[model samples]
Target: MKSILITTTALVGFAATAGAQEVNVVSWGGAYEKSQVEAYNKPFTEETGITVNMIAADNPATPLKAQVEANNVTGDVFDIEVSDAIRMCDEGALVEIDPADLPAAPDGTAAADDFIDGALQDCAVANIFWGTVIAYDTTKFEGQAPSTAADFFDLETYPGKRGLPKNPKRTLYLALIADGASPDEIYDLLGSDEGVQRAFDKLDTIKSDVVWWEAGAQPPQLLADGEVTMATGYNGRFFDAMVGEGKPFEIIWDGQYMDMDMFVIPKDAPNPEAAMEYLKFATDTQRLADQAKYIAYGPARQSSASLVGMYQDGKTEMAPHMPTNPDHLETAVMDDPEFWADHDAELSERFNAWLASS
Candidate 1:
């Protein structure tokens, strides 16, 4: 029995030693980036003795593409938005993953199963889900706040300065939704001349009320500084400001457009095996739950839902923005990256033309 125990311990030590390897990663960097590195990546290195080489980028793919084009692909694992992931995969910039080798899905959760449909695909898997919702200063609204995308366009009823993303996809979808088109109808509508024109025409009606936000971080600051009474914003930022800072802002989840960020292994990554292990570890339920504490985006693992309480009580006032909350999830319309990847250029051309005209 003593010899068997000694053998088991020896094997475990050998496995641990073998797992230690150096890997390079390219990812979006900011306060959120630092949080992830500290919370997950650092611990991972300590456990396995793997050396992590992290490259920070405001936009990771541009650098990733440059590396791949140079045939010196250094990044083992990288992060990109869903639309970008699809584009990169189509361009042969990412590696195909075998899901079976991934870490066990959180108990009671099928691996990636809790992710919204189509969120996990051939070349990428959703790392986080976020939303753009109608955020308003509760004190200013007094009696009622805008409850839907249509209300966002109802300048008279919800009368306040507004903010919207400068990007075409989000603006167009919001316009279509406000125009009373269902999520299914949005693609076909945008695909047609009449539909595209209709959306622009709607935007033309409220152009003057809008402060077009150029960056993802801009909308929240606009709200905090009282630049706009009601604006569309990423739920994570808004929730952080409202909950952490005790702001009077409130977010309406109804009609929110759900967007996702994903993880993709860059082609010809130097340490592919280590990258795969890290990917599985990052997507595991506990790690995802820890990430959610600092970043408000919803975890991709379904089992992480129950772990949400680690941050705050599930019923807290900010609960509406929690991605796993049924009420919020039910009202969300998942953005289709394929449609965006294909049509974005044309849509942007028309949208810019219309904005210039307005």
Candidate 2:
């Protein structure tokens, strides 16, 4: 009887161990992925003993949709853009994540109040506020650096091929900014046909001089390879090249396009419980704060701000490099998820047409 009782306890332990398992998370690759691995994934594993299998995607939303539609979901969680998260939530493609389930700030402040406005969603939780900005090879310019959006269009002044993304969502705003539209009025202007034409017209000036890039890693490489004098890309990627690799690159704060990245669980995730646990563990104030050490993107929680210090190098300050810095925000265009959610399809179609035309 004693031996039977011991055997029963060992079997129960094995079953519990099997239940406590891993989650597959799909996210954007490169420096952003490295930051998450160091800040969220590693620490979450250390604390909970649940392994996080990191999968890289150019954009997590693409595969997430594919998985949901096929009804064969592999990824347990996905780090996606605000527009995608909201769109998927509305379409019942993502699981609802209540804010009440989130961990609170260290000071005991409620999670709802600690996070920045729009950082929380019915089915998602924002991890960072990042930006797409103009980055230039410092060696290419002598005096009077490109300071504003108009400078990106002035090929004669800067005098080299410009690296622009092929997508409409990131390109249209800068076109309007260069055309003299204020950041506050970008979405309002882009809403009208005439306004879109105006943006494309502005882009037309640089079209001949443009060297289009699709990946986040390509812009820095474009500048490094002398393929482009200036390129627009994620600020954190630029930061990584500049600080980590000692690349001579500089970011132009003028007209930065800011957006949020959130974590969402699919409607039928492979490991729904583990995905939720990882989401809660990863987005807490400390974990969010820790991410800043690896990248320049700002943490979503207000409480995380006070705790953010130097980079992993242990000396370089992280604040001024952040997209959320006051200096960077002066002419920044904050992304409107609802606007993109509504116009993405139509504008994307039009953008493709415009791109292939001339």
Per-candidate TM-scores read 0.84, 0.95
Error of 1 at 76 (Å): 3.5
Clashes in predicted model 2: 0
How far residue 152's Cα lies from its native spot in candidate 2, in Å, is 0.4
Question: What is each predicted model's overall lDDT from 0 to 1?
Answer: 0.75, 0.91
Worst 10 residues of 1 by lDDT: 2-11
Candidate 2 clashing pairs, residues 3+ apart or interchain: none
lDDT by residue for model 2 (1-358), tens = 3433443354345336656699999999899999999999886776666789999988899999999999999999999999999999999999998887787787777789999999999999999999999999889989888888899999889889999998999999999998899999999899999999999999999999899888788999999999999999999999999999999999998999999999999988988887887888789888899999999999999999998999999999999999999989999999999999999999999999998996
Extract clashing residue pairs from model 1: none
Which one is best on lDDT?
Answer: 2
Q: Write model 1 residue lDDT over 1-358, tens digit each, in one string.
A: 3433443354345438666578787776644575478657886776666777878775677788788889998888887788888888889889887655445543434565655566577788777778888788776675766788888888887777898988787788788888888876778898999998888888887999899886556777898888888888778877767776688888878678887778889878888877776776677667777777665788776666667644443445434457557788765678888888998888888888887883
Highest-scoring model, TM-score? 2
